[model samples]
Every structure is written in C-alpha cells, then in structure tokens.
Target: MICNVFTQSIKRKYLVLAFVLVCGLTIMVSYYKPISHRYMFLPDTQVANLNFYDQNVISGFVFGKGTPMAVSCPLLLSGNKQEMLVAQSFKRTTRIPSFYYSYLAKNCSLFKSRRNYITSSLTLEEEQFPIAYSMVVYKDVEQVERLLRSIYRPQNIYCVHLDNKSEPEFRETLTEITNCFQNVFVSKESLDVRWGTMSVLEADLICMHELWKYKSWKYFINLTGQEFPLKTNAEIVGILKNLNGKNNIRKSVLNRWATRWEKAGKAPAGIIPVKGDLQIAVNREFVDYVLHNKTAKKFLKWCSKTKVPDETFFVSLHYNKHLKIGGSYTDDQGNSTDPPYITRFKTWEGTAKPCHGKYVRRVCVYGVGDLPLLINRKELFVNKLHLDFEPLALDCLEETLYNVTRNEYFQTLEGNGPPKHT
Candidate 1:
C-alpha cells in the first residue's frame, strides 16, 4: 500500500511537469509568432511585439486587381516623448550669417554630448533630432555657398530635393558642396512641370510623405527659403479644434482674401495677394483635411478642374470644417513677435523679385513694394534677406528665435506642448 501511494504521487508529479512545459511552449509561440513572417516595408511606429502576416506571391497583377498590398500597419504613436518634423524649403544659406552653428550647437538637441550617440541614419540611432524636411528649388550658387557656412550641419537631417529641370552642372556643383556637409542629404524630384496650385500643393504633400519616412514627429511646419524665424514662444495655446482641450483660436481665420475676379479670356483668373497676406499656418489635421480626406478631396478636385484657385482652396476647407485651429503669433502683450519671421524691411529696390539682393544699410521705405506682415499683426516672413544681410538676420535669430526655441524645448521637457495659431 505504501509503495502504491508513492508511485501514484510520482506519476502525478510527472504529469504536472509536462503540463507546465506545454504551457511555457504555448506562451513562447504566442510571443514570437509575429517574427516568423517578414514585413518588407514597416511604417514608422512606436510599438513593440508588432503583428506580422505572410507574403503573397501569385501571378502578375492586373488592373483594379489583387488587393493592393498593405504597405503600412496601424501606427501606434508613442505618447512618451513626442517630437516635431519641421519641413523647411531651402536653396542654401552657406553664405549667410556667422552664428548659425553657434545657435544650433547651443540650443538644438546635443545628442552627441551624451555617450553612445548613434550618428547612423538607420535603426533607432538618433536620440531626439528633429527631422528637417528641406525642399531645394532654384538656389543661386551664392545661396548654396552661404548655406554651407550657416545652416548645413550634422545635427540637421535634410531631405534636400532639387528640381529635376536644373542643369546637370548645377546638380554636380551642388552635390560636390553637399558632399562636404557631413549630414546633408540630397534628393531629386520630377516635379518642375507643375507650378499650379495642385502641383505646388502636391509637391508639398510629397515632401511630407517622404519626410514621414525619416523621423517620427508629432507636428510638421512648412518653412520657406527666404523666411526667417524671429521668435518661437515655448508656451503654445492649443486652438483646440478638439474642443475638449481648451483652445479655440480658430475663430480669427478670414476666408475671403480676395474680391471676385473677371476671367481674362482663358488666362486663368489672376488673384492678387490680399494686400499684405500670404499663406497660413494651419494644423496637421487641417493640412490633412485638404490633402487626404474624401469630401475635402472632392472639393479640391472640383476646384482643380477649374482655376485651381489657391485662395479658395485653404479658406474654403477651414470654413467647411467649421474648425478652429491653434497657434500663437503674438507675444505676452499680444504683439506679433515671432523672432525669425520678423525683419527690418528696407524700401524695395527696383527689381523683378520682391526682395532683390540684401539691405546694405537700413533705410526708411519710400517704395514700389512694401514690407508685408501677417493678419495677427505679426510679420509673416521676410523675402530677399541673404548672405549680404547675414549679420542682421543672424542677430535677429540669436537674440530672438533661438531663445524661443530653447525655451520651447524646455517647455516640452516640462510637459507643455506646442503653441497654436489660426
């Protein structure tokens, strides 16, 4: 009887051990099952243990056919450390002011300062570098030279796409200079053919789509070549179109910047810049509203079929959405004081371009063209400021914009996010 009881206990112990092993195996299979099949192009994401599916390989594809292969998996945004992607359109600023590197070195993220800063473009190498998506179109040799001196640096990740129509020699010359810059990336695009509203907008969208590949940024800002940054206030107020968040600056956006235009015998309606107004700084959602959303696309398509009027394109959508976006172009006193965007405009010299060379000396305006400022009373962005006027632009950036960017970085660190405007 004693032997029988002992044998029974041993048998039960063995059975329990077997069960535990099987359970462990099952868990392991569940954990790594996703790794079995490979995904060729995984979209930028912030998830671990991602799901995987098998590859399909039937015959050649036909029109309207075999379910277009899914390219992107559902993105899981990382709420932990949000970042921004600044899409800057630049020709080159090598001849610009002296303090460019000084500004970035002092204020921009210094991942290199810490041990083990991965400089490689591939993998999770970079710590917190903001991806600067720069579209390069028709930069004079002088401008390109100036850029090498001023803004081109390792910290900046540039998606520098030049127009395809540019002379090969120009590309060759630019590439030589670009090669000198350690982190400068060169890209070419076949988009020179279209300068219309849809074309320009499409290129802008294309730049964003390409930019999305490099960095995982929370917001993307469209920057111009001539545009300078005067101030970047850290304390941003959300113009919450998402009203539950407490910001509603969307009320101020004015849609009709123009009066009715007479179509001049097949010459596409010519609409002048609204006195002093230019483009807007709408949010990512609003941007997508015009670019991707179905209803918005339909509206844009209808517009494209006609004059493809840019004025109505943005304004109409903002009106259609009945949405309020957020961004502050003002200072504490409600003064328009974004530093980089601010400038001391001299009287316009006689030239085809709005901004000719550079202001050699500060003179009061008695001119053909006047300096333009945004509706918020803030200066929109300057044109014509170049290597010649580098000192002034540099001073403006150092004293004003750089400080704001620094503060903004800290504010982000401290948990307050980006500022908003209409």
Candidate 2:
C-alpha cells in the first residue's frame, strides 16, 4: 500500500509540470503575434496596406537606409471588430500606436552610448569629424524624426531644445526619442519660445553652452525641426573642412545705415547691424567669441528688447570686425571663405507661393514641384519640409540623397576616389 501511494504522488507531480510547460509556451506564442499582412517595410516592391508601391504617397517614416530594421507588428485584436476599428483609426489619423517606435528603439543601434564614437565605414577611414547641432522644435514629431534620421551620424552631437509651452505629450515623445540615443539629448534648459522674440536666440544659446563642454566638436549648426539635409554627412564634413576655420552666418543686405540700428538703442558704438533668416553654422572659435566676448554679451542684452532679434543677432555677431571670424574680415580672394554664407534654401511665402502646398507663416512649404529648383541649388540643406504638408517631397529627397551617397561609397570601394561633390 505504501509503494502504490508513492507511485500516485509521482504521477501527480509529472502532470503538474506538463501543465506549467504548456501554459508557458502558450503565453510566449501569444505575446509575439505575426506581423500584419497589410504591413511592409519601405522601398520594398511589396504592396502592403501602407501603399508602399505608391511612390507619391508612401510615408517617410522609414527605419533603415542600408541596415536591417527588425519590425514587429501586432494585429492580434483584429478578430474583435471594435478594437480593430479603433486601432485602424489611430493608425490612419494619428499613427500614435504603431510598430515604428519599437523598431526604432530596438534595431536602429547606429547611435553611440557615449562621447567616444565608433565608426564602421567599409570604404572610408575612421576619423573624428564631430558636428554639433542645436535643433529647436515645438511640434511635429514625425517631421522632427524624419529630419533627425536623414542627418544622423554617430560622430555628430545633437542638442534638441523643446519649447516649454509645448504640449506634455509632444514634449514626452521628443524626450523618449532623444533618450534612446546617447548622441542626441534634450537641452538642460528649455525656454518658452515666442515668435520674433529673443527667446529663440536664448534657446539656441542654451544648447550652444551645453555643447561647448565637448571641445572636440569642430563646427556647430542651428536648425529648426522642419529642415532636411541635401548633402550627405561626408559631403557636409568636407564642406566644413574646406571652410578652413571661417564662420557661415548670412549677413543681411536689408540693414544699410548705422543710424537705423542706433534708433533702436541696441547697436554698439561703431558696430554695424545686420540681418539674415537667422540660420547659422559656425566654427568652434566663432562660438567661443559669442559666448565669452564682453562685447557679444552686451550685444545679446541689447537685442533682448529689439524686434526679431534672431534675424539680426547671429549675423551681427559674425560680421563684427572686432571678432574677425566671418568672411567680411577675411581676404577678398574667396579662397579663405569657400562658398560664402550659411547657404540654406528657404522660399518666402510672398515670393514663392508653394506650387504644390500651402504657405505657413509666410514661408513656402516645399513640395515635389520644387525638387528641381532645390536640387539644383548649391545649398547644404533645405528648410520648411513638413511631412503632413508634402511627404512625397521628403521621400524623393531622401531617395536622391541615399543614391548619391551609395554611389559615392561604392565608387570609393572600387578604387575610383574619395566621396565628394554630391
């Protein structure tokens, strides 16, 4: 009787173990559902529900260029009509719930976790050509992400400045994206950015101050979230190197007389006031001058009370003969200042009426129609590309840039020459 009782106890333990294993396997299978039939990666020939074949309508939220982007999509709730409907609605209208972020966070490991960047180029040699960026964005997470991806390189440092007045969700989304990459970070100080106000300059200055601690960076460029690079990272780095230590801040031809600036009581004695669209790319020495120079500090204080300080501040600082950083102070041979000014392509609403899209705040929203003009221009970057307004333009531009880079890289591998000119 004792032997029979022991045999039954052993049988019960085996049965319990089998049940536990079955349950664990079921949970694992349920957690990782198959990707949706309607989903496919971009630039592929497959026709998913995303309309990937539609060259004009495909979304620009692609995760990979040449790298593999592992994506997981869940359509398990499809059997439930109500849940499916809600999910579809969100995907169409807001895209707030999608597999994009999962892939972005997991497979896109191009970013470095520390200041020490590692380069893995197959053709080009590993070199430290770190560029610092100050990108001030208030909204449009999709566009911002697109811009960041298009310009992202492991060697560069990016400081994102979010407006204090932005919605909580918007701020959180940006923070989450930036947190995934160590090279990209939210500025320690955020300002309530007001249009045509000094707050814009202040926000950029805060980012500049933070980036200054990394003395290895060679150049700094300020951008809004709406901008996209026309040149590849290698091309941009080459351009900066050719600058040979000069700054590229656009000097305004609008302000002519010293009296006009004097009337505002902001112009320093014997300092000429200048204006530009306010985008600037400068060398480390130029940044140092603006940050530590007593005159530049006084100029900043004076511009605080002036109208549209961003338009005038950087240009004025760059052109200051006392600073001797910009082309104005250099020789006229043009060799000292290659491809003068911060050449960013921006179309004003008053002039270019946006052939394919609407104007936002007197600035043309570039579209597919503007591609010829934009591509032919000698600008390093183009401004005011909103995904909601003209997604195709960004897509086409990205494709063009990718092809150019790929061709150049492959040519280098074939013993042709270094990647340049595209």
Candidate 3:
C-alpha cells in the first residue's frame, strides 16, 4: 500500500508538469501569432472584418513588388480589377447617408472593438512623447472615422472641430465617435469654415486652445478629415524626435494675397508677411506662445480681417526672428527657396506629372492608380482621398497601413532597431 501511494503521487506530479508545459507553449504561440490571424477569429463587424482584400496583393503592393507603370495605370495592376470595378460601381451608385454613422456609434464597446483601435501604447517612446492633433472636418463621416482609426493612439489627444455649416446629424455622429475615446473630443466652438477664409484659422485656434490644456503632448499636427497618414504613429514620433524642437512649416515668398493684407492696413507693423500651406507640425511651446504672446495675439487679430489668414498666420510667425518663438526659423535661413515640407503631400491640378486621380478644386483626389507613388512617398501624410471616387484606393491604403503597423509592433517585440523613414 505504501508503494502504491508513492507511485500515485508521482503520477500526479507528472500530470501537473505536463499541463504547465502545454499552457506555456500555448501562450507563446498565441503571443507570437500574426495580428491578421488573431483578428481572423474575431466576430464580423465593420472594423473587425478586415479581410476585404487579398492579403497577398496588399502585402505585395505595400512592400513595393507590383508598382503601377504610371499614375493613370488601370486597376489591373492591383491584382483585383473586378473587385475594384465592383466597388467603384457601388460607390458611384450609392450614397452612405449620415445616419449610418449614428448607428455605428450607438454601441461604444462594439464600435471600438469592431474598429480594432490600438488601445495600448505600442512603444515606450510613443507613449512618453504624445502628439496632439486638431482635425477640422465637415463632410464624409465614413472617411473621417477611417482617418481617426488609422492614426488613433491612446497616448495622444485629438480635438475635432466640425464646420458649423455641417448638418446636425453629422455633428451628432461625430460627437458619438469622439465620446468613445477618452482622449478625443469635439471642439465646443464650430465655425463655418470656407476655403481660404479666416474661419479656417479660427477653427484651428479653437482646437489649439483646447489642446493646450493637455500639458503632456510634445507636438501639434493639424489635419483635415480627407487626409490619411502615410507613416505609422511610431514612424511619425521617430521623425518628430529628430526635429529637435524645430517647426516644420513651408515658407514661400509672399503671394498676391499679402498685398490685400497690406492694403487693408491689417498687416502687423514690423512683421513681414509671408505665405505657406496651412498644414503644420509645431511644438507645444510654439502653440503656447501663439496663444499667450502679445505679438502673436495682435497678429492673429490682424489675420482675422485678412483673406486666406490660415495660409499666412503661422508661417509669418515662424519666419520672424524677433519673436524668439520656440522652433522659429528666420528668413535668412534658406527662405529664398522653400524647403520641402514633409508634413503633407498634395498634387496640384496642372503639374508636369499630372494627377492620376480626378481633381476637386485643383487638388488631386487620390485614385487607385496613385497608390504606387503614395506608398513610396516619404511624407508623413497624404492629402485628399475620397471614398466616393474610388473606395478601393482608400481600402488598399488602409490595409497597407494596417500591415505596416503590425510589422512595426512585432519588430519592437523582437528587439529590432527602430523604423527609419526618410
């Protein structure tokens, strides 16, 4: 009997050990599994259902295997011409009404789950050095939601300013989306933001004031709803870290619009008026100075009365040396030839390299053909992708970004070096 009892105890110990090893192996496999496989088991939802395109094709395009011959190349190059044609046909025929977003935002948990937002910080550096975004949006709730998801990071903060002219349903749906995330909120003030108008600058300022309350953010990037990020959050953080507190705003010689400001006597004295694109990447100190400094406040007031104030206000302040603004560079620092602005990439209507996508207001609305150039461009973000024009372009780009983000996260786990983007 004594021998039998000892044998039984030994058997129990062996069984326990076997169970432990199996559990350890299972966990390791689960942890090391690809994100695509993990998501495959998730329930079908708008965000959860990511198998909208062939993984092989997306991977090939993103990794630069099957680049199109030209900007106007047919969708046949993407490896799914029929599907692209069908999607394009559907988008052209159907209109996604505003209520669609209202329904999607109804259940916050399911909404987030389906959207598959990266709820945790991917890296220590990204978490510690948070970035602030001010998104000014008016139409296309679907595109707006996709853009938010593509750039969403829990560590960062976002303040969305809707055009006052936007429909009431649009505002409600946007608020619903923002409410789902603790870090994102809709701006209390809304403006009827007309193109090239002071309202555009005012809308940005409203968010700037709101975003300033969050003291932890390192940089501020303003984006429109139509824009999408070319780089992942980690990549953007890496680039911004390299800036060493210098602002990224393109400075051009004063345009014909400057004469209007001068003739109206609204241009600030002792301040040379300069013009630039409205999209900017500025540091927190610059934002604070723009909000609190006396000269900046006066310039803002003067800009309010001037035409296309949004294009001139920030660049003028950044180019002026006397302001001593953090990250400010003066005209003497290579202002004659405008250095490339890496913040945003946009193709105008009549460039030597014509827009492959249709032009809306002389700006390219990126189509499926433009993916080759877009994927290879070194800019942080690409401007103007419309869902109605070519849903496949946005779809393929979103999938590409998803793959890049997943690869980046796994690369971090393997102790690989950081992502390098020129």
lDDT of each: 0.36, 0.66, 0.78
* lDDT at position 282, candidate 1: 41
Better of 1 and 3 by lDDT: 3
Arrange candidates, best lDDT first.
3, 2, 1
Give the worst 10-residue stretch by lDDT in candidate 3: 67-76
Q: Pick the candidate with the highest lDDT.
A: 3
Residue-wise C-alpha lDDT for candidate 2, range 260-300, written one tens digit per residue: 35547847745667777688878888788788888888888
* TM-score, cand. 3 vs. native: 0.78
In order of listing, the candidates' clash counts read 27, 0, 1
Encode model 3's per-residue lDDT on 1-422: one tens digit a residue: 99999999999999999999799768855754333343233345533223332233233344233432122223433535564455445453333344544544656776676456778888887898899999999988878988998899999999999999998878888998899889999999989999877888989999999999999999999999999998989999998888878889986663565564864474664787788889999999899998999889899888877778888899889888787887878558555433357899999787775466799999999877677778878789999898878766776677678777778888888999558754
Cα lDDT tens digits, model 1, 128-187, are: 323343544454543443333233324444555565676665555556545544455565
Q: In model 2, what is the error at residue 28, expressed in angstroms?
A: 5.2
Q: In candidate 1, what residue range of length 10 has the lowest lDDT sum?
A: 72-81
